[model samples]
Target: MLLQVRELKVGYASGADVLRGVDLSVGASSVTGLIGANGAGKSTLLKTICGFLRRRGGAIAFDAADIGKLQPSQLAAHGIAYLMEGHSVFPGLTVEENLILGTWAFRKERARAKQAVERAFELSSVLRAKRKVKAGLLSGGQQRILEMERLTLNDPRLVILDEPSLGLSPKLVHEVFERIAQMKADGAGVLVVDQSARHVCAASDHLYVLRLGEICIEGPAASFSDRIDELVRNFI
Candidate 1:
């Protein structure tokens, strides 16, 4: 597995548990989907796995290394990339500049950075056309696309996304999910959390349903197709 999270627990400084004994796994070529309602601790799980939040208990292993106390930058260096909600990007910078920043780990290697940037451009011709434009000026969908492209610089082994479809039109949401699926095809493990359960089910290889800070159900994506409606109604 590229990422393995076993009985993980986390909470805020306020001392209330946000995640309680969550278990999840992602393989190098798998697309895993996590679906839940607003307060189900989905975002907390993502943050904790990426090392943005401290874990109160349990373990997180990425590429076979325990990462319970690693910092966010360290996790990224260890081949994990997180594309947070809001499709965050450096709005004031040009597309190329933002991509260069994504190559932070290899900044001293100018030739390698250049090649990585070229690969990013190849992901979307739209990005190539707007390579000189400020990121803030692109349409919302374009900005989201740019955010995904940035992950290419690191060529990460595992990719985590939170609500990638948020604030996007239906077509844009489909496109974004398609890009995530492509990551799996390219041999990168993907762990995605989204509110759109139907969309997530369609894109995932495995599905996990969380309710009240716990996993209520988990199985291969196809196994839940028949129960998706009822599952969403009861758990999501």
Candidate 2:
């Protein structure tokens, strides 16, 4: 498994539990979709996996090593990249500068860093066009794509995306999904959380439905879509 979570739990100090014994796994070269309604703890699970949120119990293992105790930066160094929801890029920097910062972990290796930026620009044509423009001036969809490009720069073994389609138009959403498909084809394990069931299910190899802070169902993506309406009515 590229990533694994066993009985994971997380919650705020005074709030009710947000994740209750959540368990999941992502296989190499596979795209997994996580679906849930708003406030269903989908984002919480991603945060825990990326080490941004504390794990109150259970374990998260990446590449067969225990990562539950690793810090967020440590997890990033281990090739675990997370494209967080909303605007994650630096508002003050140009697109190229923002991308260069993405390679901060490899700052000592100037040649590799330059190569990664070149690859990112190649993969995302929008970034190429807006390379000299400040990231804050880009459209929401464009910014999201840039975030994904930044996350993929290091060729992370596992990528976690939170609500990647949230603010995109239909056309842009299709482009994003295509990019995600390409990632899986390149042998990167991907775990994506999104509310668009049709698009997400269509692109994923496997599916996990989360409701009330727990996984309600999981199966092959095709089968999951066939039963999505019924599942949502019962679980969501």
Candidate 3:
């Protein structure tokens, strides 16, 4: 597995547990969809794997290395990238500057960084058009695309996207899912959590239905699609 998460648990200092004993694995050439109701620990699991939330128990192993103990920056160095739920771009920076920031974690390699910027532009022509404009001025959908582009900048082996389609129109949501399909086709391991079950399943190789911080059902995405309406209702 490219990423292995076993019996993970997470909770705040004084709050109830948010993630309870979640286990998940993603292979190098697959896209996994994490679906569930609001506050069901989908985002929490992503955060735990990316080292944003401290795990209360269990382990996160990536490429045979224990990563649960690493800091966020260190985790990124280990080739894991996280795209959060909302627009994460720097509002004050130009689109080009925001894209450049994605390469900050890379070792000083001018050529590679430049190539990454160009690749990001190619992936989303909207960013290319507004490269010199402040990222804050872009539409919500465009900002989300920028965030995904930033996460892919380092060519991370595993990418975790939290609600990549949140609050977008159907047209924009379709575009986001298309990009995700392209990413999987490029052999990137992806773990995506989204409220839109049908769209996510369509793009995923496997599906995991999370309920109240625990996995309820998991299987091939194609199989789940046969009963997607029922499954989505169960999550809600």
Candidate 4:
């Protein structure tokens, strides 16, 4: 496994537990999907793994190295890229400028930076057309694509996405999953959290159904799709 999370526990500032004994893993060659209801600690788990939240107990290991206490920047150095919910681009910057920021890890390498930018453009013609426009001017889906393009800059080893297809049109949502396939082809592990269990199951190799921060069911994605709808209702 490229990322291993064991018996994870987390609490809010008020000491109320949000996650309880969660176990999850992601591998280089697979797409791991985590599906659950609203406020089920799905975001919390991803946040903790990315070092945004401190774990109250258990371990988080990446590539066999214990990294439970690393800061977000340090975790990024280990080839982990986190795309949290919402549009996180610099609203004032032009789309091209934002993409250049993504290549900061290799910006000094002129040729490499150019290649990264071009690859980002390849993901969307709209991005290329709006390259000179302020990022804030783009629609919701376009902004989301911009963020996705930025993540591909340094070719992260593991990509963690939270609500990746949120507020997207059917076409744009399909593009989001297509990007996931591209990531797998490029050999990066993807840990994805989606509200739609069926959509996630279709794109994942391994599926984990989280309910109130606990994994209620876990197995190969295919095996769980048939019961996903019922499981979701039960969770509600």
Best by lDDT: 4
Go through the candidates in order and give the clash count of each: 0, 0, 0, 0
lDDT of 1 by residue, 96-206 (tens): 999999999888888998899998898689999999999999999899888988985778888999999898999999898888888888888999998889988999999
Worst 10 residues of 1 by lDDT: 72-81
Q: Write the per-residue lDDT of candidate 3 for residues 1-236, one digit (tens) a residue.
A: 99999998889775778888888999886899999999888988988888788999889999878888888878567778888767789999999999898998874998999999998898677898999999999999888888878888888888889999999999989988887877777778999999998998999998999888889899999998789999987675
Per-model TM-score on C-alpha atoms: 0.95, 0.95, 0.95, 0.96
Please, what is the whole-model Cα lDDT of each candidate in the order they appear?
Answer: 0.88, 0.88, 0.87, 0.90
lDDT score of residue 60 within candidate 3: 91
lDDT of 2 by residue, 58-126 (tens): 899998889887888886678888888777999889999999988988878899999999988887778
The runs of at least 3 residues in candidate 1 whose Cα sits more than 4 Å from the true structure, single-residue gaps closed, are none
List per-candidate RMSD values in Å: 1.3, 1.4, 1.4, 1.3
User: Candidate 2, residue 181: CA error in Å?
Assistant: 0.6
The runs of at least 3 residues in candidate 2 whose Cα sits more than 4 Å from the true structure, single-residue gaps closed, are none
